[model samples]
Target: MDKELTSSIEKVRSAVKEELTHYLAEQRDYLTSIASELIPVCDALEDYLLEGGKRLRPLFAYAGFMAAGATPTRTDIRAMASLELLQACALIHDDLMDGSDTRRGKPAIHRHFESLHRQGSMSGVPEQFGAAAAVLLGDLALVWSDHMLHNAGLSHESLMAALRIHDEMRIELMAGQYLDVREAGEKEFSVERSLRIARYKSGKYTIERPLHLGAVIASPAQSEHGQLLNVLSAYGLPLGEAFQLRDDLLGIFGDPTVTGKPAGDDLREGKRTVLMAMTLEKASAPARRELQRDLGNPTLTVQRIEELRTIITETGAVAEVEKLIEGLATESKIAAQSSAIAADAQPFLLALADSAIRRSH
Candidate 1:
């Protein structure tokens, strides 16, 4: 990353972190006041929210606001920071749904609750208790996202505008997630379907919607900013897809230490990503048979993972995905250069394009 871009990103991260700290602290107090039993929930939520994350959604929103030629206030930042809570909701539920044991190298929300249940020697199934807790906590996070945004002190007009975008984003996120879960169960592998899943499940909310959120918040008059919004969509949509593609690559090939997940975890989970679809398309019949047999086997050994990795490489899927990422990123940058973008925000969007795709984890 360029030094200037890096600094700018760090500044946004810091500001959002501060806002989260303040917001979570208030919620913690509220929870503890209600009942001592709720203390555990508060603690878990604090840890999950405050721990490591890229804060990419909020950053994109801030960039969008900047691109709209407005300087954000603390209230604006708080509104943007609400997206993190929404993400927390998504990730916690996702972990439970995927049966993931860990996130960011720590026990996932469900597993964390499961351990608490076991430690307490609670009756009934610990796994069931954990699943229940994870679901409730995810719901709480979703609720809090709405509360935080509503109380963030935006003008009534801006609040209404932001709400519209927020609602649409959440709807798209759920639709995308459903598509992904549905696809995972099906045996067929379709590149086009995988790409669609990426766009809805992770792409739109991850980048495009955030940008739209910020842009709308900056200039609440939707009609006046239609052109700018269109331009931003043009920039954001492809970049968002590229970002997910990079994430797909990271899931398969990233180092455990950096990615905070087991290597080839996506393979074990049978994520029907574009890369996997392409590999299945191009692989020899024998190789395809091997992959089909082993792709979702949770007990896969390291040696078998290496074998699958080799097969994916031999099919040239990795190279193809990389090309796709580059092309999408280029499209994003080209859109950023449009006259619709504010002069100062153009560089941020350009640097962000690089930041989005040029990552190992």
Candidate 2:
């Protein structure tokens, strides 16, 4: 990404963090009567919210507002910041489901709670307690996101308009998550099915709906709103898919220092990503047997991981995915260039498309 675009995104991230800090403080006071012992829960929520994230959803919301010909105000930025809470909800639960131990170079929320239980010698299975805590925390984040959005100081009309998109975004995310979990258990590998998972799970919520939310807040005319949404969908949908594809690759091949997770984490979790699907389709019988034997093995060794990586590469799945990413990146750029998006917003959107596909982590 360009320095200018990076600076803009950082500003949004900083503003969101500031707003989250104030919101969390209010929650601490509001829940004071509920139970003093719940302080740890509140603290965990605060830490997870403030710790680390790309804040891409908020950035997209801001850009979408701009693209719709409105200058974003402080209120607009704060409203968009609510998306981070939603992201936290998804990620916290996702880590638990995947049995991940780390996130953003720190212990996963569930694992964090597990460690706390062990340190204090709390009763009950530590793992079960951790999982329960993570679930509640994730739910709390979801509720808080709704609170943040409604209290973001937008006009009543704008709030109503944004709420529709917000509701659908959450629903789509849950649907996608369901598909993800279901596919993980299935023995079949389908490229089409995997792409559907990518579209609903990460694609729409991450990009298209956020853009819709921002455009709705700007209150464009119906026809103009349609145009803006069409343009954004063109840019967002493909870019979002590319982003997820890159993430799948990174899960298997990226540096732990950069990705902030153990290598082959996705493999151990048995995530049914498109890259894996393609590999399964193209590998030889012996290679297929090897993958089947170890793909989901928690005890898979470093040597085994390397072997899987080699098989995936040799089967040409990596090359195919790279080609797909390039095509999608080009498509997104073309859509941005040809769109009726406002002049000022075009560059940032373009830069985002570039960054989505080109990022290493």
lDDT (CA) for every model shown? 0.92, 0.87
- Candidate 1 — which residues are off by over 4 angstroms? none
lDDT of 2 by residue, 75-123 (tens): 9888998999999999999999888899988999999999999999999
lDDT of 1 by residue, 1-361 (tens): 6798789889999999999999999998888899999999999988988888889899899989999998789999999999999999999999999999989989999999999999999999999999999999999999999999999999998999999999999999999999998999887999999999988866688998999999999999876348988898899999999999999899999898988888899999998999999999999999999999998899999899998999999999999999999999998999999998889998889988888899876
Worst 10 residues of 1 by lDDT: 221-230
Candidate 2's C-alpha runs over 4 A off are 220-225
Number of clashes found in candidate 1: 0
